[model samples]
Target: MTDRPLPNLDHWIADLAPALGLGDVDVPLRPLLDLTRDVAHGVARPAGPITTYLVGLAVAQGMSVDDAHSVVTRLVEERLE
Candidate 1:
């Protein structure tokens, strides 16, 4: 892949979701992205996606997305202390 700039993430998701049969999926973008940044910075860059996957699993298991995101962010933030 070239280093071309990516499209807006919300746009990408909007296009991709229905294509994957997740047309009704609603993502809380800002909070989850914030969690990604916090995990990447406080832990390591590679941990970001892994942390996000765990959050996704929690959401899939019936936890609220916001709660899952907040739980990871708070854990990482407290770790930085």
Candidate 2:
């Protein structure tokens, strides 16, 4: 790998989203990041990506992002209990 620094999140997303056919979608970065952090800490490290993928699937299936996040957040909270 080159020694170039990685792009920041906004720049990275701007470059990547269109390539992934999500050019018009407004990605809510903070909440998703928070959710993944919670999942990684409260559940398992690997579950972070898996949970985010599930949330993405839910959004594609017509569930609101907030609702999907709420659901997963609850699950993580419960799991930590």
Candidate 3:
């Protein structure tokens, strides 16, 4: 239950994405990692996963991943200012 990512993250995601029924989807791992890190640091540590989940929902509802990331990043930046 550590926060550290697996050493072989690409392999892990390859196995995990299909298992989660997203086999055909290309996950933007680096952007997501960056988003979570910002949310965790700029907000609360516990907010990281929640914010990521919301971004996923936004994408599913037709928002582009980049747009979703931008929205969340903006919110974090504003909160930190």
Candidate 4:
């Protein structure tokens, strides 16, 4: 995946994040992507809108490229709750 600086990231995150939960978590793009990838792997599921948000969070967090992949992979099995 190509990494590009998110221009409307904050707005996108705010819109994507569900109300009455997490309270607008300002996750960096790196963590977000990592979380999504991990979530996918954890559930053996494919990428989706949720995963996109995770990627955004990861990039926003300033996570390293490789770390983003690893951390997000961890989320694959996690229950999003």
Candidate 5:
């Protein structure tokens, strides 16, 4: 790949969550996992519902996987918006 700047790509991956941070793994997976947890936390509210799904939505802010899923489930069960 050519050394070039992209639209929404950042090099912080190697800075914050490097492969070594994950463990003695052959693949660079820490950055990926860290990013995931990041999205899961960054958008998390103490409570809420109907948050984004697709990993492609990796850019949206608000509601984590756990919190968002919980609120959504509750909304479905309790029949609340």
Candidate 6:
């Protein structure tokens, strides 16, 4: 099987969110992208999305997205250090 390059996720999300009833929702793509990079590099490739899912769960539980990203990022940085 040939490896296919992924599309620009941030662009895709911005384009698709409106159609998915999240038009007005502002996703903090920068922090999330940063978290994905950090987690994938510091931990494991699969951990990136898993960590993002946890961050989303935390947000749903009343934690700010920024705060969730900060907490996870800090943990990854500390563990990798």
Comparing 3 with 5 on lDDT, the higher-scoring candidate is 3
Number of backbone collisions per candidate: 0, 0, 0, 31, 4, 0
lDDT per residue, candidate 5, 1-81, as tens digits? 233554234444444345537333232233334434444455444221223334224323553455544544444445432
Write model 4 residue lDDT over 1-81, tens digit each, in one string.
Answer: 348777697677787675546566755575555455556665645665566656557766896656756565545434554
Stretches of candidate 5 off by over 4 Å are: 1-59
Per residue, candidate 1 scores C-alpha lDDT tens digits across 1-81 of 233444597688888889988886777676677778778989999998899898888888999987887788778878888
What residue pairs are clashing in model 3? none
The worst-scoring run of ten residues by lDDT in candidate 6 lies at 1-10
Q: Estimate the overall C-alpha local distance difference test score of candidate 3.
A: 0.88
TM-score, one value per model: 0.78, 0.86, 0.83, 0.33, 0.26, 0.73
Order of candidate numbers by TM-score, starting with the best: 2, 3, 1, 6, 4, 5
Which candidate achieves the best TM-score against the true structure?
A: 2
**17-70 in candidate 6: lDDT tens per residue?**
898777866677777877888899899999999999889889979999979988
> Using alpha carbons, what is the TM-score of model 6?
0.73
Q: Model 4, 25: alpha-carbon shift in Å?
A: 24
TM-score of 1: 0.78
Candidate 3 accuracy as TM-score = 0.83
How accurate locally, in lDDT, is each candidate? 0.80, 0.87, 0.88, 0.60, 0.39, 0.82
Q: Which pairs of residues have clashing backbones in candidate 1?
A: none
Query: Cα deviation of 28 in candidate 1 (Å)?
Result: 0.9
Quote the positional error of residue 79 for candidate 4 in Å. Answer: 7.9
